[model samples]
Target chain A: MIKDIMLISELGELALIEKIRGYFSIGDSGVLIAIGDDAAVFSADKKNIVTTSDLMSEGVHFDYTYTTFYQVGFRLVISNVSDIYAMGAVPSYLFLNMALTGKRSEEEFDDFLKGVREACEHYNAKVLGGDLSLSIKGDFYSATLIGFADRVKTRSGAKPGHNIFITGNTGDSAAGLAYLKYVKKRIPMEKNMEYTSREIDGTILDTVRRHLIPCACNPETFIDKIKAMIDISDGLLLDLYRICAESRAGALIYRDNIPVSDGVRAIASMLEMDYMDFVLSGGEDYELIITSDSDHLDDCILIGKIIKDGFFFVDSDGIREKFVPKGYTHF
Target chain B: MIKDIMLISELGELALIEKIRGYFSIGDSGVLIAIGDDAAVFSADKKNIVTTSDLMSEGVHFDYTYTTFYQVGFRLVISNVSDIYAMGAVPSYLFLNMALTGKRSEEEFDDFLKGVREACEHYNAKVLGGDLSLSIKGDFYSATLIGFADRVKTRSGAKPGHNIFITGNTGDSAAGLAYLKYVKKRIPMEKNMEYTSREIDGTILDTVRRHLIPCACNPETFIDKIKAMIDISDGLLLDLYRICAESRAGALIYRDNIPVSDGVRAIASMLEMDYMDFVLSGGEDYELIITSDSDHLDDCILIGKIIKDGFFFVDSDGIREKFVPKGYTHF
Candidate 1:
């Protein structure tokens, strides 16, 4: 069985579904009915139900040339979980829809499902049900996550003088992406994965891991103090722009206060790309961007402030300029 | 305006998402937050939440040879809503995920969204949050529907003596599909849509409408009386087998009692196919099959009875044979 190649074509839809049911047997008491049923049923409490759905398609979202099936599945959950977490909710149930293409072995499918199950269990959530289909070309995965929140912190509620805050460092994911595209393969970060001579705490391996199997920040500790919250999924400037638009306000970013990993800076420098491009405009950080009236939030860094009407950024040289969102935009 | 062709490529992802958000504006008071956010937020009540997800992929699940974009969108919603209703719940919130490929006009995309909105509003559901992605291959759609149920009726409650009931006629959808495939295009079935000289009340047009744009039977009237329920997305015998397997019981389907429209019979004969093939082995009927003790149920057709141990079907000649499941299975 060392070279086991269990192709999906050799199995029936029912068998595949049954195997999925086996992997994600429900253990939550709140779930009344789970997989193998027409619909998954759960006991809903009187709270704000936060629901988000996300899609990641092969060749469009993730490249199979360098990614593992498990990474795609795990990353999909993290992406959706990030949204629910930003809404100040505890993610509870997940429903997945997958359309697979090409010749994938049963072990490969199991790896994908294992990735999904592992991520769900890590977040203390349950995989209630999922639908499977065959694709004509390239694989596509979609996940719907439902969570419960007592108080939902939307992108609104920011006012003038409110400090714009963000968690963790940016540019790691984008820099890792660049490295992957450069090397054309996954690399180990420990042994000179950094291209630059300058030493940094975070290396290219960390960046690559952040890009591939990133963990979403849980805002449980500081969610209550925030007036507005959004995940830095579409880069710092773009997500800040979303907050500004929603709250009918503007933002002023302190360039020196903005954090970028030295590893990303080195990678960007080596690749002949602007490090600011990955720092300000890089997406998929999965870090929480919060706004508060006071700059005294825990574990969150003060990066900027809400303005009266326009977006601008002050550089380390004390120069100010108009700031715009330039993250990857899919058409 | 007459020669307008709004391509998705011309519109950015943000613009396309904004259009979708505009089309499905939040009208439900229960929804605290709708589209245009990181996620959709709804006030959860103290009830059971029934959730279901389904995927329909192009080139695998559907063919564009004769189908309309409007029909595909409309059908996806119906398919998800049917699962919710089968659990005795009122469909409430919907999440859609779509990946579009090839050249699509703005009008065509609008038609697709219009179909989704129309079907959603028909069942009083709101399209919350959806993710849009570009696909490298054919178009694919996935839907996740959430509904609240005061009391959900699953398929695990049927008893040995419960009368098996169903709503609507079988073979119509399958028969219409056969006609669609035979004609090699969409057909106007008013004049001799009936394949044989045998006259039937239902025309191919009716069957085609049922097949293309189906209206799932709502089990509201008899749901309370039923001990167990399941929607017939798969064929009759297969769904019956599912119920039996779930309830740990057996079924006796009265073959004479299995209703088949004369239109389907005529068409089956004309196409050199067995009428029973479409009637018993057809999929996508969207009919509700229930088990209840009372035979005096309203608007429900009695098609079979639950037996103690073995699955069998009695024919018009009073001969019984073992019943096996044979339907369109995707693997």
Candidate 2:
């Protein structure tokens, strides 16, 4: 018979770890040292090595009330793998560090680990090892994934006159967040209206999906010939600025040519916020903002041309102007 | 004049990453791609690589109230490097993921970073890159260190009859903790006094030092010659079990030969606790426990000998006997 009880201070950290160790079994090969050490040792080869990390805090990065503990676990895995994909690499293994809240329910922990196991199967990355600890007062989570990359591409390779392109429409997450705020405000609105609370349901769901399960570019099949690339994390405009800065070139993006989804534009209009601000400053829509030479424009869509000066913008009036170099800031 | 306060929720994840892009000023030589991408790209010549990681949570691992933030930062860096040292590798670089309370006083943040910077310099490991996130509530910290190994050693590499040894005495941390607890209980204590709480003062301070800055052996200098190795993290007896289990060997530890500091002993005596329990099961000592057939007892005091069987024990009665396997556990 099993007894259900609470009171972690009685067991302490060492006993707690021992209790949890039974659940994890080591995989054969590649892992030299798995657990019970200061760190996990892995057998790595030169042909492929990938590493990325993400931090998810409680109130800042997640809310236990709104987001189920399971969704948080799934997104944590994807965030790391998404980095591997951005490197034009395949996902392989992961190492997680979980800082748990004292009041966390056992069911919540079970669901959280289940979410991790599911993501591992989805991406084929092995959950090699991790460290688990209890927080003092509040809860937090972080993860680092090590992947495999053969030939890698970087953001510093963008050149002047190179065509800049992106994978999908921008402003999804930004608009969805605005919609959430509007709904929370209890503002009266029509049912089934496009930008209203109900009509925006599907778009918000899709945005949430995109925000959570970050879609990675198929790096294995396409990374070899790529010149300069970046994940569209910061808005397209800001990401372009980074690519240009590192590559020692400037870019002039045509405002009309930028991809802004219908739902995104409608939300921006409803909120009386500039569509361009969502397109320029809004973040978390993980897409690829890539650049290739002018000759390769047919190979990729031409959003703008990289110039020698710095970040530039071309409006619908055909007037070219300079733009500030600001992206997302946590501090 | 810093009028705009950036809430992580307002910017989301991508824009937050973009906001920090300007801070990455130095060009990484091995980097094929840095920030603003899915994963940072790194290139290297075909060679065996050593990688390790560790996580430090707020309450479980440390107390910010008594422990200076700088010491906590320094200790985190020290802990990861010690693992690399245990493998006989020269640490090359590090990647840090620090989750801040975000509402930290500037003084606190600066002190913490200073600790990190100083530790990096001490270990000769460059801080190549890092991620800073606003945590939910507690301060969360984790680090991954990459090192180059000339001759990597595994715990399973031990052969039958190899001598087992450790670098230094153990259980200092437990002694320190006991002392800290006694002091916290408002027990009046004097340094060098025979009282359990009294003997704890000096012993606790010394043990606390051992807990923070462990003696790290330059593993690269000796790992090639060593047959099997593991850090004495969980305890000497437990770690010996791991080496024997992996190497398909057995070990007989000479309990009388095990090293114990006077301070550790004093604390144990005062607490009316078994000295062997503190030495046998105490975790986080971070000293290297090695096994080699070459008979290098002078280099490190020999504590045991490998046998052909599965497991054996040297008891308080000075008789050797068979027993169940033991070690520290991490969930």
Candidate 3:
């Protein structure tokens, strides 16, 4: 077979960055302080700034077997934003750094930038300057987010009696991942790419969609009341365990009270697997797991409470047991 | 031969991050605003802030055949610091993100961090936090620098009558790189990793040292007098071209006035190569290129003058001609 594909190696690095810079009009986004300078210069009026960065590499953090550059780029932004939002900061500026294999096509690059722009627009965050470089192997995408907040929240602020709340259903993305691996193809959720996700069936559509291009939830509505906060990237139990460890407390959660999606149940049933496995330990949910003292909090689901020192879980039959955290771990 | 090296894959991502976090005592730094939170939080009182990030990848940006993790790590910090310094910003806090392969040894990892710490301390910058993930192929390192300044200088502020100044000798690092590529092995620059550079010979030691690990010049001493500035990451002519295009001006350079290091001249003569090639177009010198209206400035070499419209180069014999830009570009 004859493959006449144009590689980025032929285009050169500055050209690639120029293509990326073209995606976002920097003047309007407020990143043009020193446009042609070595470093980006700007002024901030806020009292406090929250910054977070995450790197997603090819074949390790993501796989092209069932995902596209667009999905990966969008997910990268959300992951960083999830961190800022978890710190009770409003994400304002985003900087993207990409290291791609020399053989990647320009089409792939454009699609990735498009995904980044869409997600940034959805969050009202401006795209600032970043870097584009070459990698010897698979692609690596990183996003460093800067947000401003008057008061910041850390994970070590949870008290023993604080209620453990989750922003949304857990394991849908993991469940979605399961189906995508089986199919091993890009399953289109919508014909056109839009910021809003389309409603779909649990059996195939939503699960696959969630796994491939999961959306990161924003926790702004109740960010002020949360004493401790973390985004559930490394599974619910594992991340909750982190909060407890940092806060010097423990957590007790009821399995029945855990919010789950129909997509997860459908995938577990079809794959002859335990749905609880995905609910407890599957990664990349990107939901906010918070601790708060308020009982009448809005936009959150109560599943457990902070304990003095032990990690415990309760089944639907009211049987309680100790559990260890097992989630995705990269080297 | 059986190798019993401990790999980062075995240590896992979180443990590797913990290992890195242990390197820098973070409580004293301004970055601990929300320690153990999703994002880092801190307060900045300066009116203007400058930020810059760069990614260096294996086989692309650096090669293990001629460099060590220590040199690579140290070089990474200097590279980003150079950008921030070029903007006339005092680099304050730095965040490092690394993606390593499963086969990389813990020793290499530690050496890299040591280099990072040594460079950070040299610049009086604090190590905050960054992500450590797994890459399927070679290692990738990235650093994001946050610096504060009351006033900022950019490359766009130069005009037709400004005198171009360079912080130090150009083409030294590029000459060093050629030697390292020829040698194809790690050369010791210093026995103990101190912040200061040890004196060495032009033929072998200094050039090789410059290539393996180079120091980025801080333009603070002459910063206030300069109207425009940029760091020479690319060749002298290419970067000067950038300043010209951005400032809507041009440059006229003298062949004898452009500072050429003894190391560069020695290597070029020994190799029977054109020394002007390295002086004109060599990349990674990391010296600051600034333009000032002042007649005389301390601690800087006057290399050229901003011309009215075209890039003109004056030879040592008083012959003048237009020139083209050529520098390093990665895909």
Which one is best on lDDT?
A: 1
**lDDT tens digits by residue: candidate 3, B74-93:** 88988888887877778876
Encode model 2's per-residue lDDT on A1-331: one tens digit a residue. Answer: 8655443333433343343233223434344333332123343554645567677887766555545666677767776766667666677656666766545655566557666666766787655444555566666677777666565566678777677776677777666656655655322221122333454455455554454444554545445556777666556776777677667788888767778776677677878888777777777676677776534432344567777876677888989887886655554
The superposed Cα distance between candidate 2 and the true structure at residue A91, in angstroms, equals 4.2
Give candidate 1 regions above 4 Å deviation.
Answer: A1-45, A186-202, B1-45, B186-202
Fraction of the real A/B interface contacts present in each candidate? 0.43, 0.28, 0.35
DockQ of 2: 0.14
**CAPRI verdict on model 2?**
incorrect
Cα error, candidate 1, residue A36 (Å) = 33
Instruction: Please report the TM-score between candidate 2 and the true structure.
Output: 0.74
**To one decimal place, how large is model 1's interface RMSD in Å?**
17.8
TM-score of each: 0.83, 0.74, 0.84
How far out, in Å, is residue B230 in model 2? 1.7
Better of 1 and 2 by DockQ: 1
Task: Tell me the tens digit of each residue's lDDT in model 1 across B1-331.
Answer: 5655443334433343344344234353354434321112343565666778888898776676766777778889888888888878888777778777635544456557767777877787766656766677778899998887777777778899999988978888888788777767643222123433233334665777777777867788776797888788778887777778778999988888888887788779879998999999788889988999998679778988899888898887878899677676555
Candidate 1 residue-wise lDDT, A1-331, digit = tens: 5655443334433343344344334353344434421122343665566778888888877887777777787889899889888877788777777787645555456567767776776786666655766677778899998877777777877899999888899888888888878778633222213433243334666777788788889989877788888888878887888788778999889989888887888889889999999998888989988999876888788899999898888887878899776565555
Which of the two candidates, 1 or 2, achieves a greater lDDT against the reference?
Answer: 1
Candidate 1's TM-score reads 0.83
